[model samples]
Target chain A: MPAALHALKDFSDIHINLVGNQALIEAELASKSFDKNRLSITHAEQVVDMDELPSKALRNKRQSSMRLAVNLVKDDVAQACVSAGNTGALMAISKFVLKTIPGIDRPAICTSMPTMKGHVHVLDLGANVGSEGESLAQFAVMGSVLAKAIDGNPKPRIGLLNIGEEEIKGHQRIKDANSLLKLIDINYIGYVEGDDIYKGNVDVVSCDGFDGNIALKASEGVAKMIGFYLKAAFNRNLFTKFIGLLSYPVLKAFKEKVDPRRYNGASFLGLRKIVIKSHGGADAFSFFHAIAEARLEVQKNVPALIAQEVATLLTPQVIEATHNEI
Target chain B: MPAALHALKDFSDIHINLVGNQALIEAELASKSFDKNRLSITHAEQVVDMDELPSKALRNKRQSSMRLAVNLVKDDVAQACVSAGNTGALMAISKFVLKTIPGIDRPAICTSMPTMKGHVHVLDLGANVGSEGESLAQFAVMGSVLAKAIDGNPKPRIGLLNIGEEEIKGHQRIKDANSLLKLIDINYIGYVEGDDIYKGNVDVVSCDGFDGNIALKASEGVAKMIGFYLKAAFNRNLFTKFIGLLSYPVLKAFKEKVDPRRYNGASFLGLRKIVIKSHGGADAFSFFHAIAEARLEVQKNVPALIAQEVATLLTPQVIEATHNEI
Candidate 1:
């Protein structure tokens, strides 16, 4: 509640509809000073637990805070919605309330990753586990559109994530998707290995949710492991600890440069409405970034842009040709 | 050649047969001091290029250095073989020359990755692209045996890499493999996500070649990205540069703790004979580590151990039941 109020104070142009227990939200907000006109509370009767199954939440919790937030978007009461709730439940509720955009088979979870040059957007972090070649092509198109809409890259270079760069490598589905992407109107670059994600040469990378989830989690694992090792190395002895203290400025600079909080929002692309899924454990600073991301998507009108692009590119002939080629 | 000679100098018990042009080997070795009794040269009429197709190398390059090295192992002239050549060609040649162990479906590329605790062995790095449930079960068995033989862990916790920890998540093949692994005699833990790879909770992780390759390369990518950011941060200004200089010893300690060169070799497990593949761009130090890895495998008799375990656990009823369940 404090994070949301903090975000409300920072973004002067936007209004927030905090959906939960009105009394509890009022109690939390009593000490904080903010513009009363810029914030509203919608009383929701239920809340989704972090570990609750998506199906059970969807069926049982019709008045959930997550559901009410998505309903606000659906009813045009809000331009966008950002949640730091259970990912599965949020995805289920958002998909159910907002539905998918025209010509998109499903919504993909897309997020920006820090890269050497700047940052790159990757999709299908863990939405649908085993997507077909056509679904992969859809992910590529959606990722490309989101990249262009958010980054203002007129022609963002798109790459298919694969085991190898060789055309002969990877599964048959990947090869089929590669063929389909080449036929599409988007700027589809050839295959890219996992290492290429951080090189920043490609603006967007698309893959099955299974592979994408693994890649993202593996990257997180490595980052955390490195952090752990750095701490251990610095705390080895008094001399090293003194050196670490002296080097604090440089380390701080590096941490700020690659801070995950700065890149907190993950857009649910291919949906009819703009929805951002913040990291579940986000603090006020990180949650503020997620709200900023939502405001950006609202300004850009990302869903309308994606709908326009998909209508123009996904012709029946092109889809048939890709399926036939596979 | 120098790296090989350096390794020969370090390990007094191992003999190395320099398989290539004998005249060129002698020219490279003339300036280096090494014991004469520990080194021999075998002239090969052909060489495998870095980009050469594995099939072409196997079909045409009968007298290639890679082939000769594997042949020496097959003939018992050498206990184990190590090569810093093309991965595909090396796997193809090694499998062709040594063949698969009984009850082992295919050979997997297995390597150790640095973790928070120490390191964990991960298999199917890039040997096969799309593996079935049975093949994944086979990989688990082989990886478990290699971990036990090398790490001396009586019961290594084996994890199957998947998108989620839920029983119903991930591809059918993965779920099928999970069921089969539970029926096997190894220490079969439930599904683990990608971040678990570096958590040091599991001793071995088994996945298909495609997912494994992506996870490994993504890890390399993150490490390199972090290193690049650290360099950039330290070089930002004159004051930071001075601090970086003062912190050199601490930084070096962290780098050595997670040095890729220290974890150079990838074993071709399930092969009839032990084969180690070094990174193609390896320097003398890194290549020496690869040689040391091969020596360790030879000492542990990895292949024979894998064969024995596979024979004991992979009963016909278990295989048939897994296939039927899938």
Candidate 2:
């Protein structure tokens, strides 16, 4: 908490409102044991418990902390809303309040995870489940926009996550989306396997929310597992521990790169305004990171750029990419 | 090359008769530096190139290395066949030579990967792309048999990899498989997600080859990336490199634990005889691991056990698990 506060303190001009019970908020502040002169903490609705899913949490939208945070964006009180709350509820409230950006039928939750080469962003991680081909195409466009906003790579290469690199492979929906992406001339790089996600063959990976969510979490689980085993190996004995000391700097650096806190939030792409959905289990430091990401998206004007580009592509919506005849 | 040769020394009794051009074999042998005692190099038909996909390579079956390997398995010259070559070609040839075990429609390839808690074995990673409900049920039965064979568990808990943990949430095929699995005495734990692959929620995960392959490789990619960054971080500078020394033992231990070689081959389940399909890019160590796993499976008599146990449940081979429900 102190580290998060310190990091946020360096950038004091950024507005932040703390939403929850007065007692919990005060408890968090009092425990900090440091002066809070530079921080802006305002009261909003109480947060819904993390245990609750979006379907159930959204029922109390009027008083939910997530609803209140998203409402801030809706009311223009904040340029972008950031939260480490129920992602599903956050998506619902943001869609209801802020509305989808022009030309985007559904919003995508785009999150970043560590890749072998560097950081890569995947979209529709869990925003909408059971997605169709058109929705996947929308995710590709939105992910490309987010990648450019975060990484500054214009015309980012897009890869449809599939079983194989061939166009004929994958589920029916993926095949349809592949054909569509190819005809659009949007730097489509054909299909990529699951391994490509870590290899960084493409800048943006797009998939349905369910599969994307599974992939992201699975990757995290695998990384953490590897880290655990590495520590065990280092701690094997006195001699191994001595070797561990020698390898400490490299391991720490690797952990830092793989840490999710560095890239904390998944922007709810297609929203009229930037709406970043932080992981529900995130702590103060993670929330701080989410706010930082939100600041970047706001400054980059990602939503406007995406709206402009996708609109041009959709005017004719050239379905010729299928090339079924060829 | 020396390390591989030393490892091969442990299995010196095994003789590899390379029935190909003697001069070419000798030249290739010189390049690999494989110990002559462990393998008797000979000359015979050509081997299949690993680079080509099965659809094209399977056309000329007689000359393919994969076909030759399968013939060796059938002729009792080798206890098992391992191939890092094209998966489809290997499967096609193995099916033709070994044939499917009774009550099994087709063979499925199963492999284990490191996870947060331990390791997970998922089947049909890429053998059969479009599996039906009954096929998946067979996979579930076969996967459990294979898992028990290697893990030594009495009844390995089996799971269906789907979008959700709920039985009814997945596609129709899964819904049908769920019902069938529920009726059996096997420890069917219902559905699992991609994340569960590493969470250690289930011992055996069964899915269509397409999704399974994508998920498996994606996890591998993430692990490799983490290992890469950790190395870089340790090598940052003199001071951090000192810390890197401290962490080296643990990190290396983790890498070893998670190394794919430790779980090299994916068993061709549902086949009449045990056949392990090694990764196309597998090194000598990985090939050796595949041999080890195949030996374990053979000793366990997994095919006979599965044939006996599932005979009744499948005898009335319910067309669909859904029918069992009605």
Candidate 3:
């Protein structure tokens, strides 16, 4: 809130969508004591319950905070919408409001997951489960664009998540999708194993949301579990404690470096507008970082670039098919 | 060789089909200094190549090491077979040599992977990549039995791996398998997440080999990558070094506790004869451990128990009703 307020301090054409209790939102804004003329705060009448039944949260969208945020983007009150609420609901409203870009089938929530080597961006982790072949191909395209915009790579090497490195691997749907991606001239690196997710061998990792979510959760749970055991082991004996003393700097460096909070922003690619889905458990700092990402994405015109690329890639195929069909 | 020879010296009438190079087998037997009458070492003309094509490894009727191992069990030349070669080949040979246990459609491989919390015994890691409804149900039944016999669970809780936890969740195959498991009252635990494998939340985690292999590799890769970074970090600076010093003993204890050597045996579960498939990269110790497990399973008559239980479970349903017909 402070960062947004500060950014709008000298601007006359800025407003904020404070999606929560009316009085609380106003009071929080008042406490900030920024240029009142430059900023306007609109309290959202309803907020989606952030819970396991994330899909249900969007049902009461008439007064939902997420709906209001989408409305701001739709109404041109804001160039981009940002939310740290229920991701499912945010994706829901974004689809309903902003709509997918032309030549794009479905929008993908793309996030850069940090690896030991560096970073790898994976799409559709929580946005869409049980993806169709066409949609997966679309995710690959959007993920490549996102990586490029982030300066991770000019044409990020894209990998389809599979059990093996063989061409004839993966589920039937993924197999069909592999053929579709081959038609495009993208930098498509073939099948990648789960180990590749962290090995940093590929920049863009794409999979159905079900597997992606499972992979992300499994990775996170294992890390936490390892930390727990490591902590327990450190307290085992005096001799080991002495050894740990010698290794203290290394362990501390690792913990600080691998912290998830360092990369809190997740971009919803392939939308007509740029939207960043922040972590549900994000703090003020993370929320600010997400907002910052939304600003950069909007500035970079990532959606427009993706739209252009998708059209270029698909138009020829579509035209050839139309000719062949005729 | 030494341990078996020592046992042979103490307990008479142990027959050994010593396959591979005659000189090496003779030297090993001679070094053990066992009574010549107690240890009968018959040299086999051939050994199974680890890199042989699966067809050659699987279909070769010649006395290939793998085939010889299976033949020993089949012909009562040896009580069981233990091999630390190609797993796919072992599964194939086990099936071809021993035949499937009555009422079991396909063979499943059960391996115990050390999770962050405790141990998770996972099934069908590679044996059956594309399992059918009946095959999965059979796997569930067999896994439950193995858990009870080996892991010492009175009634092992079995979970079907799926995209969701609800009974109504998952693809058609899982739904059919779930219905079958429920009908038989096989201690079914509905569905489980990928992380559940490491969280030790489920006793037996069953999945198609594709996802199972991916999940296993993902866990292994993440732990290793983090360990690598942590080591690098420990050497970075001084203050972090203090934290590492504080945490050494507990981590070492944790590492020792989860080392794969403790649970190195993987059983090819649907065969009529006992076949323990050791890791291809296993050393002499792991191979010997696999042998011990195979011996135990043979002595306990696990295959017979599985066949009996599975037959009892399926008897209630019409034998004429096929999966496709359903």
DockQ winner, 1 or 3: 1
What TM-score would chain B of candidate 2 score versus the native chain B? Answer: 0.87
How many angstroms is residue A279 displaced in model 3 relative to the true structure, after the best TM-score fit?
3.4
TM-score each candidate: 0.98, 0.87, 0.85
lDDT of 3 at B176: 74
- lDDT per residue for candidate 1 within B1-45, as digits (tens), equals 777888887888899888999998889888888888989999999
Order of candidate numbers by TM-score, starting with the best: 1, 2, 3
Q: Candidate 2, residues A74-126: lDDT per residue as tens digits? A: 78877887776666667777888888877678998888876766777888776
Candidate order by decreasing lDDT? 1, 2, 3
Clashing pairs in 1: none
Chain A TM per candidate, in order of listing: 0.97, 0.89, 0.85
Q: Looking at candidate 2, what is the lDDT of residue B114?
A: 69
User: lDDT of all predictions, in order shown?
Assistant: 0.89, 0.73, 0.73
DockQ of 1: 0.70
Q: Write the per-residue lDDT of candidate 2 for residues B1-326, one digit (tens) a residue.
A: 23235446666545455544567767766767566666764344676665556655666757656676677778878766666666777777788888888888888888887666677788888777668878888998888877777788787889998864222245677777878888777899998877778777788998878768777777878877776776677667887766655554555566677888878878888877778777767787887787667767767877777787678677574544458474
Worst 10 residues of 3 chain A by lDDT: A317-326
RMSD of each: 1.4, 3.9, 4.6
Q: Which regions in candidate 1 have their CA more than 4 angstroms from the true location?
A: A165-168, B165-168, B324-326
Provide the lowest-lDDT 10-residue window in model 2 chain A.
A317-326
